[model samples]
Target chain A: MSKIKVVHYINQFFAGIGGEEKADTPAELHKGEVIGPGMAFQKGFGEEAEIIATIVCGDSYFNENIDKAKAEILEWVKDLAPDLFVAGPAFNAGRYGVACGTIATAVQEELGIKSMTGMYVENPGADMYKNKVYILETRDSAAGMRQAVKSMTAFALKYGKGEKIGASVEDGYMNQGIRVNFFEKERGSARAVKMLIAKLNDKPFTTEYPMPVFDKVDPMPAVKDMAHAKIAIVTSGGIVAKGNPDHIESSSASKFGEYDIEGLCDLDESTHETAHGGFDPVYANYDSDRVIPVDVLCDLEKEGVIGKLHTKFYSTVGNGTAVASSKKYGAEIAKLLKADGVDAVILTST
Target chain B: MVKEIERAGFPVAHICTVTPISMTVGANRIIPAIAIPHPLGNPALDKDEEKALRRKIVMNALNALQTDIDGQKVFEG
Candidate 1:
């Protein structure tokens, strides 16, 4: 019988503040105000729910000072105590998606409020925060604002009203790996047979379970003149310094290790071992070089096959690790390698 | 991880025993290794022979990195 109170969050551009030029603007909370996409959401909510306030922050400002920005926004959301908090359907704007995810997740986790945002499935923030919070998949840009607002507002009202959320595909949200049981008109065997028949007949049939889609990246041009290139080694075989200094997990590694191998020609049993539990560790432990090939790489460097061997090698366990986590680590390690002026990388996995 | 590095504009040569997984994960350049546990080593061989085997794999990986390609490729090791 009572209207649900809602708070909306947006980036400076969406708030009509400005674009990249005004991306340094700090957080601003407009209490009792509806701005930009909030208007669309307001219309979608109709009389069932009301947008109580809109919190806007510059994407750059939020990402650059993430802690301060999150703290500031958290205080505002807690003060308003809205039944639901909705951030942007940020789509493909990388930093905006991250900001939305951070604030939305904080509102839900730190304030015990229902919060959600929407973004493209491939956005870095989507991978980082999808499991931590609800993220509705949106088109790659704001051009989908109308459809995004419609779906987001519907989900917002349903969740705000304490209604049970449906499966991701049914509700149009990214899959968070939560399974809900429901009865269907046909049994699984019947569905399987139907699919088989359709496949044999070369007919179109939707699969009950879809394989994960991987983003294909065009190959970067090959490194020219290996004789003058700086090469680095990275491994998912979980090789680490003796005693596993960083304590990299034996499986489903949560973090990667960066170790300096300067002035070293090889990784030996006493100096290094593997943390990978996926395969037998005896061979790799007997000679850490077995997994990382540091010895051979050093030999190549000595022979002038490469101009230099980067001093640092990154290591992480891939066994059972989430694709999201791997992608996050890979991106970070790539940044570090680029900063070090490394020209190429050799990545080994088991 | 291979795709991430390549996506960032760095040429990456992925060395793994499973070429299909490498291709599935969008690795542009790949070199098959000796085995899963000892990707570069053949423990059954004498230490010197094993080192030679590893050298061959490493050489293949290096070559893969320097060979330009428009799409995914698996090179000989």
Candidate 2:
């Protein structure tokens, strides 16, 4: 049987060429040469796979000229046409991890071969390429090379042999945010009940799905004067003009609406309604001011409690909308409001 | 969205029934709304009474905007 050919990728430090001083070295391909870390990986692979070639590039050199380096590296990888491409267990080195992920993803995507890499979870490259390549989780530094190589070698052999790759947890790889399915011994309800019991008893319990982290924004200083300040209204409660003119999605809002409320004193059933599908639309439809507070804003303006009510108000349905889309809408709205000389905003939501 | 508005340098008073969600999303100024459907009015009360409730809530929101706060703050209606 022919040995599975492997192409290994490493930075200058791992290639025994130099450290920070040699970081500007250009890309080089060494035929049948096992560099520093490659020796450990080779021993791990044993007779199952052979390190056919090693690709080396400097950290600074590769990252500074990514486009040029990628093309050069891709050409070399294609020429070797190895069965498996193994990039660095880069640890926490930012540039090296990025280089590994970039090249490994390109080799798999461009060359139609299996590629794998390893790096620490917090490395910026992990977020950039984890979803594209098989990234084995490694320690923050090189002290964990023994364990990293063992896992990588095992995975490389399985992939090279055309065996199915298991879930990230079972295969000892970083979670790539891809959902995998397998039947559990206990039903989902039973598992939930068990987890609840453990939680109630002050015991540790792992959740099936981890919650995503949210950004904490520091609050800005409040507007100083209510009597002379220009105020604006914005809502995520799906308040829009009557007939739903923009056709904004009733649930996961695809767009926002800006209506002229210049001389309007109140929002009644005839003039406004809600496009939100998350809550009961009856009360809001009966009186749109219930959700937007446009009526009260106008009252405040007349009573001189506020200097002026901005002529236009922005509205959108926040239910089930993607975070990315919401972010886009917020940025655009802020730009518009800032340009309009709106000093403060009353943001209403359901 | 509230966070985005505040980030753009415009102070915002977020009125919502779900105060916890509002607080969690990093809204600087928070004012409690009546309920989910009718944030300003209470349909269960008399028309005049409901109007009074909404007016109070809106006044609170306006007051929240003018109050100088360093971090997340909940204003009472």
Candidate 3:
């Protein structure tokens, strides 16, 4: 009989405030007010729910003072105690999407409340917070507001009522690596045959499981001179200083290690070993250079095959580590190597 | 990891036992290693021979870095 109470969040632009020039506006809470896109959501919720409050913050203000803004917003959401907290269908606006993601995630995590937001697939916030929060996929711009509101409102109602949320595809949310099982009218063999025939006939057919899109990076130009190029070594082979000083994990590595090899010519059992649990450690333990090739690299340095060997080598275990984590470490390590003026890198993996 | 370093404007040579994974990860220059345990070393060989094998592989990786490539390409030792 009672409608679910919802608290909505939006940026200054959507709140009918000035655009970029007004992005420095601080947070404002309008109790019992349905503003901008919240009207569409209110209509979608109709009899099932009501927008009890709306929270608005400037995109730049929230991002520039993230902690302060988040703390202020969290206090308001706590006071409101709405059944569901929803942020923007920000679409392609990078800063707004990030703010919505940050605030929504904070409300859910810090306040123990159910929260959701919507954004385009390529929104930086989508990649940063999708796994942590429920982000509905919207078009690249606000032109898709109607559809976004319908889908987000439906999902919000289910979640606010404690109903089971369905698969990402079925619910119109970004795939967050959660798998839900459901039976279909046809069995595996029948579905396979149908898909095959559709493919053969060049008919459109959706795949049950879609492969993840990989980021393609343009190749950097080749090193012009091996004789003068400063080179470095990096590995996902789990190599580390003896005794595993940093205690890098044997598998599912949570961190990477950067060890100084400025004076070392080789990596032997006594000097270094592997922390990788995925492979036999005998060879690597006997001679860590077997995995990192530090000895040969040192030899190359002497032979003038390279101008110099970077003093530090970065290492992390790839065994069972998440691709996202690996990518994170890779980006960080690359920054450090670049700062060191390393011209090229040889990345070894086991 | 290779892709990240390459993306940062540095030529990168990825030497790994799994060439397909390197290709999938979009590494431009790839050199297949000997095995998963000791990617650069062949334990079956004598000490001198093993060191030579590693040297050869490292040389191949260096060569991969020096050569221009259009897309992903595996450089054989």
Candidate 4:
């Protein structure tokens, strides 16, 4: 009956504002004016959905101050009364995809609105937030701008129309491996068995979905002095304080803070919490040390079998993190450890 | 990438859950872990058992650093 009101979210560059220098700009809401891809979306959606407002902020700004950024953005969007939200066709840009994914997931969760974004598979944002939000698979370059926008808008239209939407990959969003409850025409186990039999018979049968390949990384050469080396432990298992008072993000983490336990031996529920979004949070919450095993490492350090342990251990939520970003963070930490003259590292992953 | 790091002359060993994947991907030295999430010790086990498991794996990793091999090597207990 009425036009579907939409709010468009974009980063600094697409906002036609500035570059890295403007990356820290706080969130601002503008009404009646369409900027950047907002113009393209306005054109694509035609009159079906009106781009009621456009929210823009610098990527670095949001990253550096996520809580403040999310708060400000949420404040701006509260009154816009948009039925749907759309972020960028971020292409292969890492930060933009992250920003888009973060904002979209938050909007979907907090506002109870459908949100969508377009990003290439390599963008790392797709892997991290694809399960939480609708991320349309896009090409690495801006060449697919028109198509991506059109596709995203079409999906938005379906949402606006209250029509049942199909599965993610099929509907242009990256598959989150989420199982949806629906009445299927075919029986599930029977179908799978039939397919399995066909595959066993050497018949060409496609799996319902194939798992994405995480880039295989080779192992570095062994440490020269293992018996006498100071090995540090690291974990993405979100082992922090009981309430995560440090406020580490659940996913796509940009901050890693270390807790000091120099004199203390073990971690208790009141002392530590998990911020990792990848796994079931219940298990980790019960025993923070179980995830990172700081207690075990501490005992190992106390035994004098190895050199003095590094006082501070690195921590960040690794769930839904991009491989490239993870590698970069690893390098940064490695450099820090190297500068500290640390001999060897025993990085524990969960 | 790890090889590149190794080529840069830092000797590193991997304690990985996916030994097959690590071997296939060509790790210089691989020490096996129980699972993907908790690689060293399973939380399901008691504290002492978990410690023993972790100690064993860490020892294997330590051994990997000392032992010289021609290609990707997996430590066996």
- Give the candidate number with the greatest lDDT: 3
DockQ of 4: 0.12
Candidate 2 reaches a DockQ of 0.28
- Chain A TM-scores, all candidates? 0.63, 0.61, 0.61, 0.60
Over B1-77, each residue of candidate 3 has an lDDT whose tens digit, in order, gives: 88888888999999987565566567889998887677899879998999999999999999889899888899988
Q: Candidate 3: interface RMSD in Å? A: 9.2
**Deviation of model 3 at A37, angstroms:** 1.3
Question: Can you list the residue pairs that collide in candidate 3?
Answer: none
lDDT values, one for every candidate: 0.87, 0.85, 0.88, 0.71
Question: Which model is ahead, 1 or 2, in terms of TM-score?
Answer: 1
Arrange candidates by DockQ, descending.
1, 3, 2, 4
Candidate 3: lDDT of B22?
69
Task: For candidate 1, write residues A104-202 as lDDT tens digits.
Answer: 999999999999999987665787688888899988767888889888988998899999888888888888866667899999999999999999999
Deviation from truth (RMSD, Å), model 1: 17.4
What lDDT is reached at residue A141 by model 3?
A: 71
lDDT of 3: 0.88
TM-score of chain B of each: 0.95, 0.93, 0.95, 0.87
State which candidate has the highest TM-score. Answer: 1
User: Taking the tens digit of each residue's C-alpha lDDT, what string does model 2 give over B1-77?
Assistant: 88888888888899987565566557889998877667788778887788788889988987787788778889977
Candidate 1, residue A237: how far the Cα is off, in Å:
31
Interface RMSD of 1: 8.6
What is the iRMSD of the candidate numbered 4? Answer: 7.5
Measured over the true interface residues after superposition, the C-alpha RMSD of each candidate is 8.6, 10.0, 9.2, 7.5
